[model samples]
Target: MEFRRPGPTPTPWSYWLIRLLFKFVLKIFYGTIVVENTHLIPEDGFPCIVCANHSNSLTDALLLVTSIPSKKRKMLRLTAKSTQFGKKTFTSWLIENAGTVPIQRKRDFEGQEVDNTEVMHHLMKALEVGDAVCLFPEGFSRYHPTIAPFKTGVARLVSDVLSKNRSHSDFKISILTCSITYMHRQHFRSDVLVTFHEPMVFTPKDNPELLKPVDYNVIRDLTAQMHQQISHGTLDSPSWGLVRTSKLAARIYAPLGTRMSLGDHVRVVRTFLDAFKTVRKKRDQSLVQQEDDQHNIDPSFISELETDLKAYQDQLEKCGIKDDRIRREILPRRTIIYRMILRLTWASFLLIISMPGLLLSLPVYVVTFYAVRNFKKTGPVFDTYDEIAQYKLIYGLISGVAVWVIGVLATLPFVLITSLLIPALMWMTLRWIEDAVSSFRSFTALGRLFLIGKDTLKEMYDQRKELHGRIMDMAIALDLPANPEEYFAQAGGKQKGRVQGLWESKAKYFSIRRRRKRDWNETLRLYDKVDYPDDDSEI
Candidate 1:
């Protein structure tokens, strides 16, 4: 591939083609991808900067590059650490072609963007030309779950851009905050939920505030907003266990029969976190005004409602059942049968169309997978968990390309007649196979739920209902709707569990199958009343 840099103007055709390729490649890696509020991107020739949390390294950039519509690819520019592109290797070449501009992570002094003027210039130039510059304000990706403190560079860079573009009255640049959540960060073929928050705009007028010669108050304020917004995007607790438990709790609190995946579960939490704030704000306003209307909600009401929801989630965690099993335990028998029949029908069609491609790709993928397992022994140099997935994808991509070339060479003489035909056929079929395999796994899991016996299912369902009844009692006291669906309807902003889930990737599943196969019965027993008495005092 030819190397190219995105300039002040739009990139050439080759740059966008590789970006398109990236779109397809990433989709293959992540089986279930949910991108929300993408329509918020305005392409009206206004300067834009996408400020997102940095966590997953190159995969983060790849996701942002492909998340928007293909038409917007020409205007997208991604930020990379200078070290990533210093060498002229194939990966570096790919980054250059993908419209990356490097920022120096280290400055002579901490908390200063005083150095790296050229890097600043490139970012400013992109914004000046009505292009969208993507940046991770945190400066570097942290391997941990928490969002790192944003470096002062983003605020400084935006302040500088506003000052430089003062002459254009019609020009306005917007910083879009994107929050990306992965169900299993290091795990391959995990689910991803990319949510785009509203944009923050800066006109020429804001420049004077930033241009103050002495105090950096304006910069500090901007950085604070960035920190808050990015933090909203990240899911963090003291440890991964809390994060995992919180994730499962969110799914349980979601609407029944939705079968929400961990990624979607996180999105629900993100959406409700904002909604919870809104409800509180409204409640506070009512309290201060002492509204005469009988329907007016008291602030204490929402407070209790929040507390009850927490208790409900805590009790479910104490029950030790996953969201999928919970759904199966309570769903109507007819609905369960319908889903099984539908999944079986779909699986048969997938098998017929996808078997050949699966055969073609399996051998190369197997060899590459084992090869990269050795590299994992060195462990991750960075704190990132995505190293394993990255290597697998990189090596798998090479194997794919090599095999395709071999296929072309072998099809010689007839190659011209079938070049486009063969490649297109293989790509579609291979993708179908991947999708089919994932769905089959999910189907099998659902089937096993039925096999767990009516006695066990009833026991689990009774436990869930007992906890849910307590939540309803609290809801009734708060003078709010008791049903989960009804409460969601009244919230009136985002309804979670909107998207149905997809199956997990087989290659990734097999890698950690044992851990996932942990005895749920034993887990439940550990949480049983025999182990620890509940508030009811039963053992």
Candidate 2:
């Protein structure tokens, strides 16, 4: 095979062709892809660098490419590992065609010294030609909730390019941070959020003169800013367990009947995590001051809160009940019956309409499912759980398109007609599957309400309330905002003024509710015929 060097700028035709293919693949793989702040990307042929957090391997790169609007998408050049291009494979061809810059690393090839001098020159040349280069500043992809430490490549490249070109009046460059978040990384047909933050612009006329040899402090500062921008747009939890706990706390604290978008849901989770961490820190500090012990919360209280929350979650799981349903489904018996009837009626109608599409697309579904499952057991081992979903997506698209092509060829007499009809059927099949899953969840919630009884349901609600109250207690003890949103907003600043009175009132209200609950329990005990001994006195 003859080797050809890619153009200084990306090839528009190849770039868009690959993008269109991946767009179709991603659309089917992810149930929803929410892109925020597209205006931040420079579109007027200005040199730009995009620093992004790497998580789900190719899925991250693909989603980022597809998320950008078509006007600027083709100009974006991606960076990939040098090892990817070493073999004569489809991946190498695809990356080369798409104009990916190969990055070299020493660890990738043990004992063999590696240098990125050529790679850096290629990136600088591309950016100088009025094209955007997307670099994963984390250096490599990993299944991490929080972003990894950023490499200095971004800083070095930017300073070098800008310092060299700063004499020209028209020279300019922008650095944009892209953050990607997945609702369920390994789950098929899950939702993803991609956000493009405001770019850090550098120009010839800027006051700060970064000379040929930029200071280490300057590079570190730039890296920190990039990290902060990327981290702000993601859920920066330390571990997956903390991420789960934060999400649960958000759901429990949110108002009933409130529908939050993925972006808003993420913000809510971040808020809970911030408040939780802050209060725990204060609790630790309070341990040293004996005089403050009366007012300060116990250091173990945080763990106790987490333990109780987990128990509540476990109980709900056992009962086949979701936390949101506890509030949404607690209704009068007649009202429940009415809602169930209406739900079943709508579901039946949907099922009847979707049957034809489902039947037509069954072959595509079965082939994709078995292929993915079998490949997981016998195919190349996946390093991260999220990587598996990307493979499933690619394989599913290949299978679906292959099936469509074969169908068209089989019916040669009506090739054009069959080609169009098959895709339409597949689309309808997807719509029906989504509707069916949603209806199933609703029906299950109703079933739980009927089978589990309202008394048990109310107990679950109380447990949620108790857990929420404990969180509020922690907030009050730390003199933080009672509302998680307020705490998150006022974070990293003095928070004593805004939420003090508000949290005090909230604390008093929950205290009264606790007293009422205790009184109700006492009344129930008095009504019992058998005399109960006081356990505290006997012990």
Q: Which one is best on TM-score?
A: 2
For residue 206, model 2's alpha carbon misses the true position, in angstroms, by: 2.6
Q: Estimate candidate 2's RMSD in Å.
A: 12.7
For model 2, residues 1-539, the per-residue Cα lDDT tens digits are 22122434545688888888988778766655668789888884678898888888777887878888867645578888888886775556777787788888776989888888888888888888777888998888766565688988898888888776766756778898988887765454556778899998886568245556667888888899999989888877555555656667666664321223456556666765654554555556774222235445555666567667767766776776566677564777787677777777776776777787776666667876786677567633323443666666666766777888888989999998989988886676565555455555566667768888878888887877788787677646655456754445344222111123556645643221111110000111112111122222211
> lDDT (CA) for every model shown?
0.59, 0.66
Check candidate 1 and list the clashing pairs. none
Off by over 4 Å in 2: 1-10, 86-90, 204-209, 255-258, 277-304, 329-356, 374-382, 469-539
Number of clashing residue pairs in every model?
A: 0, 0
Off by over 4 Å in 1: 1-8, 70-73, 107-114, 165-171, 186-188, 233-236, 255-265, 271-322, 326-355, 380-382, 416-458, 470-482, 485-539
Worst 10 residues of 2 by lDDT: 512-521
lDDT at position 225, candidate 1:
94
Using Cα atoms with residue i matched to residue i, what is each candidate's TM-score against the true structure?
A: 0.69, 0.78
How well is each residue in 1-539 modelled by candidate 1, as lDDT tens digits?
22122334746676777677767666666645667778788573567888888777787877887787755435578877776786866668777777788776654246865457887787787777677888888877755655777777777877787666566555577888888886565444455778788888877665567643525877888888978876776564333433443433344454532233333456455443433344555566775334324434444544554555455445444544344465553556666677777777776797788667766677567867786677756755344344555565566776777777777788898888566765566666655554465455546555656566567667667756664554345334435444655555344222222232234334344221111211111111112111211222210
Q: Candidate 2 — which pairs collide? A: none
Residue 369 of model 2, lDDT score: 71
TM-score of 1: 0.69
